[model samples]
Each structure stands twice: as C-alpha cells, then as structure tokens.
Target: MKRILLLCALVPFTFMTSAQNSRPNIIYILADDLGYGDVSALNKNSQIPTLHMDQLAREGMVFTDAHSSSAVCSPTRYGILTGRYNWRTRLQSGVLWSYDPPLIPESRTTVASLLKQSGYHTACIGKWHLGLGWQQGENGKVDFNKPILGGPTAIGFDYFYGITASLDIPPYFYIKNDRITATVIDSIKGATGKGFWRAGPIGNDFKHEEVLPQLTQKATDYIKEQAAGKQPFFLYYALPSPHTPILPAKEYSGRTHTNAYGDFVLMTDDMVGKVLQAVKEAGIENNTIIIFTSDNGCSPSADFKELKAAGHYPSYIFRGEKADIYEGGHHIPFIVKWPGKVKAGTTTATTICLTDFMATAAALTHRALKDNEGEDSYDLLPLLLQKGVYQRTYTIHHSIDGNFSIRNKNWKLEFAYGSGGWSAPREKAARTQQLPPVQLFDLAKDIAEKNNIAGKNQEIVKQLTHQMEIIINDGRSTPGAKQSNDVPVNYLKYR
Candidate 1:
C-alpha cells in the first residue's frame, strides 16, 4: 500500500514537471502608434505593405476588435503593464512627459513581476513611456549619469534597454538596465517636416534614425541569448517607430509610395521580420509565442491628408484618428502566433483590451492573480486557442482629453459629445452648437459610429451609464474584492 501511494504521488509530480518545462517563451511586440489599417493583412487598401506583419497574422490568430486601453501612448502603456485603467491613476488626461516621475507605484504588481515570480527571465527592451525615477541634480535638473530608479528594473523586468519616452520626446538617450548608455553633454535642435523631434538634451552618440534599428538588434540579441538557455523567457519589445520623427534608415527611406510615414511603416515591418527571424534562427520559433499589437491608433503626425491623397487610410473604416473617442482611436491590430497551440489562419471578432495581457500571462504560468493585481484583466488563453467564447461584459475607453466611452456587446455609449479629442467638431465647437449630452451607436449596424441614437435609446444609455458607475466604483471590471481608485473619477462630469 505504501509503494502504490508513492507511485500515485510521483505520477502527478512528473506531469507537473513536464507542464512547467513546456511553458512557451512569450514575446510581446508592441508597435508605437501603428493603426489597425496600417497592416496590409488587416486592411486591404493600406499602401504601405507590411509583409512580415501580414505573415504573422496569417500564421496566427488575428483579433479584429482588439483595443488599447486608452487612445494615447502613455496611458495605454500603463494599462498594458498594470491591467488597470490609467484614468484611475493621478494622470486622468494626456500623456506623461519625458522626465515625468514614475507612474507605477512600488506596491503595484506588473505583468513582468508576475511572470518573474513564475521563474521566467523577463526583459523590457524598447520605449518605456510609463515613466522613470530620474535622479534630480542641483536646480532640479535631471541627472542622466546616475542610475534611474522606479523604471523597468524597479518594477519587475530583470533587464531593460530602451528610451524613456517617445522617439520625439527627449533627453534623447538610451538606457541599459537603468543606467544611461552615454553621457548627455549636448542639446539637439528640433526639426520640421517628416522627421520631427522636439529640441532637447541628447546623448553624444544618439541618432534619431538609428533608434529603431538599435533596439531591434538588442531584442534579437536578447532572444538569441535566451534561446541558448533552458529557462523560458518573456520579452516585452516595445517599438518606437511608425510613431514620430519618421526617421527611417537610409536603406528603408523612400521604400513606400505614401512618403516618409509610409516608408517608416515599411521599416517597422522589416524590424518585425528581423525579430521573427531571430527567434527562428535561435531554434526556438516552435516553442515561442509572439504577440504583435500596437500601443494605439496612428497619430495625426502621420499626415492624414497626405496619406489619404496617396490612397491610404490609417484608421481604415473607423471615423476618427488617435486621440478621439471613436473606434479608430483605440481599435488596433492584435495578432498572436503560438505555434501548435493557437490555430493558424484564424480570425476572431472578440473584443479584447491590452490590459488582458496580465491575466493571460497569469493563466499561462498557472498563477492565480490576487485581487489587487490585474484588476481589469480577463484571461485570454481561451480566446487565443479558440476554445470557446470569452465574453467580455463591457470595455471602457478613454480619450486623450478626459472623455469617456463604454462598450457593451454591440452597443456603445459616449459620455461626452464631439470627438472628445483632436478631431473636427471638437469639444469646444460641439458645446458651442449645443450638441446632444451623449452619443449612442450600435456598432454592429454602424461600425463608423456615424449615426448616434442617444435620444432614441434612453434605456441603453442609462444602463450603460449605470454599469460604468459600478465598474468605476468597484475599482475593477473583473470579479474580485472591492478596491479603491488612486483618485476621483467622474466620467459624467465631462458632459
């Protein structure tokens, strides 16, 4: 009887060990300001040919109604990392600046931290706009030579090599594992036209055009190094390109017919190809899971007029661009390539938020998330494998300005009128005209969000509004113990 019991115990233990060893390496590739229509596979009319991105889409599961948590860079990044709404934090509107203090609190658990606890070698190699703790010098100047605290390393990532903010925002320098790679002794002047970057302090060796390539090389090198090891790795490769400074390398410049921005998109696609090639070269392609998504929609810096003239629509069939409350603002490309796990050449219209990444990782690693962690995240493992419908009750959307919108099934309700961001009939203009107090759209019938039926559907507006209030007050969308928001948030006040 003792021998039989020992055999039974060892059977389960063997299975558990095998499961741990089979955990796939995860690589999350985040594209900066790349829109849904930017990828050729998603949008047939896109002038910029994103072959590599298309290939990834074809080989993996593509989510059609995926969105960034917020309509802009910093907030979306915050939601992606923390699995909580950015509006709940002190920053209710706009993006964080280059030298802003760390936004993520020390106590907060990030996706990296969760995975790190699961024995994964985690690294964040790219734009970390969520903020960093820069050591201040005399007269409140940022000390670049010192090690910055409360950054990727401080949070959860074992290693970090990236820029602090957008490519355009400066203190233009590279940070490798919390330390500046070089001393910033000079100030670079701003440039106009396509390659636009704010004039600010820059490292002596930093170059605008070299940012994307350098980061790509670093990511590829990291992948190669990790592949040689037995431990499964997690890499958050946040891309800086197709966003600003539109500085494609000499070889990539003029590669597209849609001018500088399109050329930059092509370069971004090539970088994606390089990363994919790196995984394959390392002989870990089959065991690796690559998730390619954008931080948010395309910015107006891409020159909508010029792109339209060249027969390219960055927002695709959506109504507005990046910072608006419309679908285009947050609706982004979400593709996952998990070889032998997720079905290939499959697509789903399941609406998912970038915030879901945390919970998904937790599920993959067999870790049960605590109530305080991944507050807004829903496990997407089922959706990835197409096992069943992972129905989301609702998704809250935030704009560049402090406007709010809620989506429940096919119905959407915007709390404020106008674009609620940077678009025609802006908040001031719409208010001057005394537009409706709110807007409602049936997205299934009208994906463009053109016809608002708020006056007709009073019950839906009330229900959605009530749901939003509940979600806000509860401090989370997912089921858990009641939590508290960092600050006060009243979405209705925007009206």
Candidate 2:
C-alpha cells in the first residue's frame, strides 16, 4: 500500500476522484480506418454527415492534432493497447496475418488488464487485429476445437467477442472468449472495390454484411448489462465498419446518396449513435467516459477517386492516405465526452498520440505504471481537463513500410524521401528519380507538405533526428527507468 501510494505520488497530477471508490465507466470506440475528414464536425467540406461522431464532437472535446502511433491498423491498435510504439515489437511494419501468434506477450500490461486490476469489469468487442495464438493439428490445419491461447482473455479482458484480424483477412469467424463460436467449413473468393475481402476459409455463420450490425448489437448489449452492476466497466468497442467489405446493411445502403463508401460511413455513424443511445438508456451517460476515434486514416480502398468526384475528401486536405508517414495517414479525429467533467464544444490543437491513453488511464485510476509498462505513453489528463499545457514534447510517427518521422512543434522530419507506403513516388521510384534522401517540412508554413525544406534546414533536421535516436535508444519517451525493447528497431532500413 505504501509503494502504491508512493508511485501515485510520483504521478504529475492528482488522481481523478469523483467520489470515494467511484471510477467512471469507460467506453472506447475505435472506428476502423476512418479518416480525419470523414467526420462532418471535423471537416466542414465532408459530403457524408457523421451525425453521431459530430454529436460527440459538439458535446465533448475535439483534438485537432491527435494521431495514431502508426499509419496502419495493427500497429496503431498495438500502441493504443500497450502504450508502446509498435515498432519496438517484432511487427516493425505491416499488419499481423491471420493465424499468426499473438503480438502482445501474455505478461504485458494492457489497458484492459490495468483497468481490471483497478477493480473494473473490462470487455472488448469487435476487431482483435493484434493476432491470436491458434493451435494447429498434425495435418497443419487450424484446430478450431482446441481453445485458442494468448488472446484478450489471456491478456486481461473478462469478455472478448470479435473477429481474429481485419475483416478482409481469411478464416472468417467470431471468437467468444478463447473458443471459436462456429466451425470454418466454407471458402470465399477475393473481391475488388468497396466490397473487398480476401478469398479464404469462412465459418458457417460469418457474413461480411452482418459483421458491423452484429458487433454493434453485442456492444450495446454489454453496456446495458453492465450498467446494472455496481462495478465500473471498461468497454473497448472497436468497429469494423467503413474499412473493407464496405457492405452497408440494406437500411444504410445508398443513404448517403454519394457513394457506397459514403453510405458505409453513415452506417458507421449509426453504430456510434446506437452505442451512445445505449449508454443514455442505461442512465450511465453522466458517469461514463466515452471516447470516439479511429485506428488510422481512411484506406485507399474507400475509392478516393470516386469520393473526390463526389467532392468528398476523406483525408481532408492532407497530402496522402493510409500507410503514409504524412498527416493523412496517422492524424485522426479524437473526441472525448464526460458529462460535467469536460466542457462542450472545446477544441485543442496540442499534439497527442493514441498511446497516451495508457498513462491517462493510470491517472484516472490513480495507479502508477512501472518503467517497463507504457514506455511511450504520456498522460493527457491535463489537456482533457483544460488544466494546463499538454505534457507531450514530441511525437514519433511510423509508416506501414517501417519508415520513421518525428514531429516537434511545427517541424516534421521524414527519414524517407517518398511516401513510404502506397502513395506516389515510392521508395524505389524516389531513389531512381534522384530525390532527396531525407525530407523535412515546416508544417506551420506548409500543412499540405508540398515543400521539402530539408536542404535549407539542416540544423532542425539534425536536432529532430538526434531526438528520435534518443527516444528510440531510451525505449521510452516518458521519464522513467531505462527499459529494453522487445526487438531492435531499425527504422532506417526499409523493406
């Protein structure tokens, strides 16, 4: 007890204590690949109206410079859960494949586990992209009958119901806890455009169109059920919509009158509305901390050309799309609503990363994290409560190709010259065309990143590069005891 109190004392701010032994119920809603401009409240020019997301923005605090730690889905999810840079893990680039071993070690302290330790009931519904430990039979086939290992249940979630990876990944089925709810006895074919899913083995009950709705129902059901309990509950509801297999249910189809993807965005918003409605109906709205944000920027599969034709820009004036090191890839919409605790219609441009959730959660619960845990996380309670300036000094961004970029105030330094992912002037092309080896931009002067001023700004480049090296070598951005990364992170050597 003394040690715990001492650690808590080391924390920067006083613990958020609404009432004795009372903690706010937390609901974290992560939209899969939803763009910064997709929310109408964030982007004035967005053609698709995201009423639910917009409502959250209007009622809560909107962060203009919020970013996912990585420019892709899996890495961003990893950072959010563990509060450590995904590059420090074995998955330096790209996403985990279906049937891959668990990305997070069983002993790692996750946000779910942390809350659970603090006497909160935790549940995770929808999209577990951080890989699962699936047992294989002698014939090299997945043993669906055997209980899966190293999943959400192993990590600390009391309840977990979600697909293994991205909806596009193969072996489609749902897992309740560590068991497969159904058997995979069918096969599927790959698709193109908005309805894009890889061809693979599928379960008898799995359907692309029903995934979003079913997950939504599960989330609402959980909220309603948990409201009756005396214990505070933490619900990490990750929506799989508006990502791929853009199959908006019949009711939402063509609802946007712009494109299939736009209609799908509406469907996503409806899911958010349902969750919000569930909290209100349960009478927990006043005591719940609701956060709505995206894992990463909108994927190119959303048909950027078609959306542009319709005058809707998902990236919203950003230079690149998903898998990029630019603002469009990692910069995302972040809204937090806690009735009476947060002022409505407030906005802050202070830069923050998704990894900050860890320390923020620690602050809320009045628990201090050890040096090894939440290595890259910083507490954002100050910014959320409008108490003072944010504690984050700089943010490190990662691309799908493992390239690194450091953002300090108005300047950004990209280690790679090209887009680093699927954007134009790829690594090979950039090198062939004799482009600069490194690119630096003064984001204050050129938010679009049209100008590369590295030639004239060598000192700023060197300074940011040094800071990045220190952050990488120290294995943490926050002040703490020295820690070791799971693996050596060599961001300079890109694939």
Among these predictions, the greatest lDDT belongs to: 1
- TM-score, candidate 2, is 0.95
Q: Estimate the TM-score of every prediction.
A: 0.96, 0.95
**What's the distance in Å from true for residue 280, model 1?**
0.5
User: Number of backbone collisions per candidate, in order?
Assistant: 0, 0
Q: Give lDDT: candidate 1, residue 37.
A: 94
lDDT of 1 by residue, 289-359 (tens): 99999988888999999999999999999988899889989999999999999999999898899999999
Worst 10 residues of 1 by lDDT: 384-393
